[model samples]
Target: MFVPFLIMLREGLEAALIVSLIASYLKRTQRTQWFGAMWAGVFIAAGLCLALGIFINQTTGEFPQKQQELFEGIVAVIAVLILTYMVFWMRKVARNVKAELEDAVDQALQKGANSGWPLVLMVFLAVAREGLESVFFLLAAFTQDVGYAPPIGAMLGLATAVVLGALLYVGGVRLNLAKFFKWTSLFILFVAAGLAAGAIRAFHEAGLWNSFQAVAFDLSNVLSTQTVFGTLLEGILGYQEAPTVSEVAVYLIYLIPALLLFLMPARPAASATKDAREASSARR
Candidate 1:
């Protein structure tokens, strides 16, 4: 439940922020007439995401047990890749996202042919990218746990994101986006590590991976995943009471390096700019 909630919250806010940035740019540029087309794109992209998610979820349920496990493993792997890419991509672009969006809007409107369509396409592509990422992630998360809690938590997270997005657009609230993303990025890495481990377990269950099948440790007696606190940990961090050796290896192999790289301080913009200027001077 907590896993889905946090994932959905982060994903939904990303999409919302993109939409708001585009909208804000359009309004500032006196392109309010294009608002209708922009909104059309958003709604269409959202509907497509919803429909696709439902279709995938419904169809996957009919597979045989082994095949189902294989499919889950495949989905989990894809979700982890997408989630990792998203975290780093946002980290790279968050500072310049507004400028990038404004430039995109300008290019869209400047196109001589079918200007409105370009803007619509731009908005659609941006939102759809985020939506698709969320869909794959939610599918992986839902497959791991059964019952209404995850779904309900996801919906609540999305609702909160929408309200927050609105507040931001209206200047009703202010947030330190840098800090927010930093904390959330750390949380997401933990989730992705768990998914990586879970994917290995799923592959083993599907009879695809057999090596290193030895149990890493047995904690079921002390901290069974079925218990309340254990369930919370399982949901949030992919805790397993008796994980296999391969699962433990995969978890640490992904998590440790990911954390080190993420925590390493990024090069300052001023330093980067100075280096670029030095290179240009040498070339001249």
Candidate 2:
């Protein structure tokens, strides 16, 4: 439940940010007439994502047990990849996202009256990117646990994000977006690592992976997954009571380096500019 909530919150916030930015830009340029087209794009993209998620989830349910496991494993892997890429991508672009978005809006509106369709397309693509990411992630998360908690949590998270986004756009809230993203990125890395481990476990269950099958350790005696604390850990961090060697290895291999890289301070813009100037001078 917590896992789904947090993931949805982060994902929703990202989509909200994109929408808010686009709307803000349109208003600032006194092109508020395009607001209708912008909203149409958002709704269309959202509908597409919803339909796709339902279709995939329903289709997978009809598969045989082994096939289901295989599907789960594949989804988990894809989710990990997408989550990692998004985390790093957001980090890289956080500083310039506003400017980039404004530029994109300018390009979209360059067609004058015909710009309506182009702006719609631009917003549609942007929102759909985030929506698709959320869909994949939610699918992966749902595969791990059964029941109503995950879905409920996701809905609540998304609702909260909408409220927050509205507040932000109205200048009613002032959030430290950089810190928020940075901390969430760390949490997401952990979640992705867990997904990586879960992927290995799922593959093994599907009979596709048999290497390094030896038991790494047995925590079932000390902390069974059936317990409250254990369940929380399993849901959030992909804790395993009796994980195999492959699962443990994959978890550490992904988590360790990911953490290191994420925590490493980014090169300052000033330093980068200085280096660029030096190179240009040498070339001259």
- How do all models score by TM-score? 0.93, 0.93
Tens digits of per-residue lDDT for model 1, 1-284: 87788888888888888888888867776778899888988998999999999999999899999999999999999999999999888887776676667666776777825568888888889999989999999999999988999999999889888988888888898988888889999999999999999999999999999999999999999999999999898988899999999999999999999999898877554554455445433433
lDDT by candidate, in order shown:
0.87, 0.89
Instruction: Itemize residue pairs with steric clashes in candidate 2.
Output: none
Error of 2 at 106 (Å): 0.4
lDDT per residue as tens, model 2, 53-96: 99999988989999999999999999999999989988887876
Output the worst ten-in-a-row residue range by lDDT, candidate 1. Answer: 275-284
Residue 123 alpha-carbon offset, candidate 1, angstroms: 0.4
Task: Compare the candidates by lDDT and give the number of the best one.
Answer: 2
TM-score of 2: 0.93
Task: Judge candidate 1 at residue 23 and give its lDDT.
Answer: 85
Q: List ranges where model 1 is wrong by over 4 Å.
A: 112-114, 268-284
